[model samples]
Target: MSSQFTVEKTQHPKTKPDQQNLGFGKHFTDHMFLMNYTAGEGWHDARIVPYAPLSLDPAAMVFHYGQAVFEGLKAYKTEGGRVLLFRPDQNLERLNISNERLSIPQIDEALVLEGIKELVRTDADWIPTAEGTSLYIRPFIIATDAALGVHPSPQYLLIVILSPVGAYYPEGLKPVKINVESEYVRAVRGGTGVAKTAGNYAASLRAQEEAEKQGYAQVLWLDGVEKKYIEEVGSMNVFFKINGEVVTPALNGSILSGVTRRSIIQILQDKEIPVVERRISIEELYEASVNGTLEEAFGTGTAAVISPIGELNWEDKQITINKGEIGQVSQELYDTLTGIQNGKVKDTFGWTFEV
Candidate 1:
């Protein structure tokens, strides 16, 4: 059993029941977990504070230099009314990895995990019990020292906020249209793309908004150098099915190694599906599509577990995948993924951690 963190809950004076229709990141719980860290003292002053605005100096290092890292995971209220986390240790480990890349000090993994559970328990009422709904946990660290110099801060603040989120595909798991980015690059070699840092997403916002303006749901980013290999989407990892085999871009220092992506690969491999983690080029994907070998394509992440890619649109070329609908492999992957997550199936991989 995980050690429990002491919580100081602040009751929301005027709170109402959240509508089930409220989508992801809209509704928040009443209390939040926080801790402060200093270079000399290390991590200390852990507490459960009220869900309120942060007090940061105008000349804070995070404001000027963008020294921030974040993690996204979920707390699920199981059918048995028990709150659980899916591979939270993996998220904690990834968060530290991201912190190292950002020059921030590492945090205690066990303490962070314990604090998250305590926050969720305090805000248990905020966790939606409906299917496909969960409490989205956002744990982040930010440089907090009031300094104008472009150097690492001597102090940092870590926080965990909980939000009740509905299904990514509220209506259904329909296919999404993706625009192949030719001009913009999300991450380059030796860049911070592999880490879950805010700068990466901040860099991709322009392309994402442009994609939305152009009538596409998301932009599929390619390698920065050659612009031929598929890296990832704005917020999810990409996967392609070619010749009845599962293929995803390997961790090549330019793409995030998503937890969902790893889980899907493990699930498929366990079921005797040929899973390959290699560099998949855009031209090869197009060729496979034209030859009827590219059976399906999808994006995987924590928010959107598995979203099908119906069509890929590039410069003056449009390729339809799986007849512009969700394929067998995509559906199976989604079902298995969600099933294991919601406790509807046996956790063969021991992914679930009861909170």
Candidate 2:
């Protein structure tokens, strides 16, 4: 792995958008980081080039076999004029986990991190300093072998693009309604459930569409084997505060180990709050709601950070959590996590990496 990167500035720079109206992932930065991998030659040709469309053969393996993986993180501009990245190492490590699962070549984590830092530094002006805006970083890899085969491609392209995105939800921290999906299963154990591959999200589209039709923000998935145990939410990990304890479904090889989820758990434990990870069943959750013990429910991930789940619609039996408002725990966690990311609060865990 080489530490050198060729730089190419865009000849025609586009006008920057208003930070106030920057929606999620709608606008891209001027440049992107790119690299290539060959089966025998390893990863090479690392460079920072102008953002542009890719030209791939019609028979590209990624188009046919779906041998692709991606990871998302964000870079924040602090109030004091410092730029920070939140736990990028964890995301890259998870990317390699996905690569191993998909039979793709392992990436040089340190080298990739360097590339990301350089790219972010180059595009530092694009980092929005608005109330809830930051530069979203998307790193992805796709099989590029131009063959109609159902196997891993011998060649791969790795790219990292930046987007100045606003709050993932239009309502900000306001609670959202989620549908408990029963008809569709997102992933199964021993499958590609845990891996952050393209297929998992593709498999979730139908259920998500139906949930949207029902006026829900996202769908809560259940275990595929029995369809009784709680799995995760559409794009985040689900958590519940029942009775006096905080509980999230255990990572049973079918749920993504979200970076925000881990940070929340750590923050809870640091505060001496009771937090547990185990196999939580939907029936148990519903029973808790019946007994009036189900207090707060939220989803944690990179995009939304902490999405307060206000209502759970299970087979038309809607249960409003925390009176359909944000709970104390959810609010505190969101504030603390976002504070650390933006350098407003002390990062006791040393999670943020300064660029």
Candidate 3:
């Protein structure tokens, strides 16, 4: 919400080795963007300060209540060296939705765009020109008011940080095995699951660790009440191919409405694929898999645009999908999505925002 910003320049004094193969969210850029928000003053004191530690009170509300929300996106450099952003407006809109749900004051769309542009332009050189690498941008707001109560904090801090990230899967897109957890739930009805808040991810750590120990890439979270309907997988939204239709879980107040998921649905519908957005039960998926109706399964998100789900391990049963490889439709979807993102194909939907 802060419109006034004092621009400053800083540098990363020490550099690491040529770690070209570094995975996502590992390295940081030179500077960061920060802005403060108070109850009566709204947002103010915006600055592009050095990327360093934050001085917070021991009794900060965020430390106790976890009143924080964040969004993730990327800045890509095109073939002609023209940097661009894919559907940044969509990300900004989603950030506001997250903020409102978390009791934080909504940010002005224009200011948010300007702040993002300023940060990306300041760190433009950090945008990796390599094939699967780009500048990963993380914008977040946290409750900073020194309060011990279990309520929303009146003061908050909004900041954006950049990171040079390699391809999510450096070895090319590979199918991942997922384990469905029937014990723990990622989201519940009327909860903060839809918001990109810190608590949701924190609650998923135990399940993720358990999945990893079981030789699964991520946990396929089911609905909280019944634990029968499919919600999402890890942090990504899940998709399924049943019969000849491409279907995903309907945005029913529990799962995150990912920008990548919306883009894929639009592309599918544009190409005349029978794309359906509805509640999909785990039993239906298992039945479809057994009857050869479920052809493929995958997850969609910003980090990995579309990741194939090779196998779904539930209970003691293992169901292999698309023969442990990327399916026909999944490959096409990935190609079209990434092509539009990298400026290789025509962006009919006007999703690419050239910088």
Q: Best-fitting candidate, measured by lDDT?
A: 2
Model 2, span 1-355: residue lDDT tens: 2348988988988899998889989999999999999989999999999999999999999988999999999999999999999999999999999999999999999999999999999899999998878899999999999999687789999999999999776567999999999999999999999899999999999999999997999999999999999999988999999998999999999999999999999999999999999999988999999999999999998888999999999996888899999999999999999999999999999899999
Pairs with backbone N, CA or C atoms under 3 Å apart (clashes), candidate 3: none
Q: Give the CA lDDT, 0 to 100, for residue 252 in model 1.
A: 96
List where candidate 1 sits over 4 angstroms from the true fold: 1-5, 13-17
lDDT of candidate 3 vs native?
Answer: 0.88
Task: Report the lDDT tens digits of candidate 3 across residue range 149-211.
Answer: 888899999999988888888888899999999999998979998899999999999999999
The CA-based lDDT of model 1 is what?
0.89
Among all windows of 10 consecutive residues in model 1, the one with the lowest summed lDDT is: 1-10
- Candidate 1 lDDT by residue in tens digits, 1-355: 2334456657653373565686878778898888999999999978887889998889888888999999999888888887789999999999999999999999999999988888887888888887788889999999999988888899999999988899899888999999999988999989998899989999999899999999999999999999999999769999999998999999999899899999999999988999999999999988998889999999999998999999999887898999999999899999998888888888899999888
| Candidate 3 to truth, TM | 0.97
| TM-score of candidate 1 against the unseen true structure | 0.97
lDDT of 2: 0.94
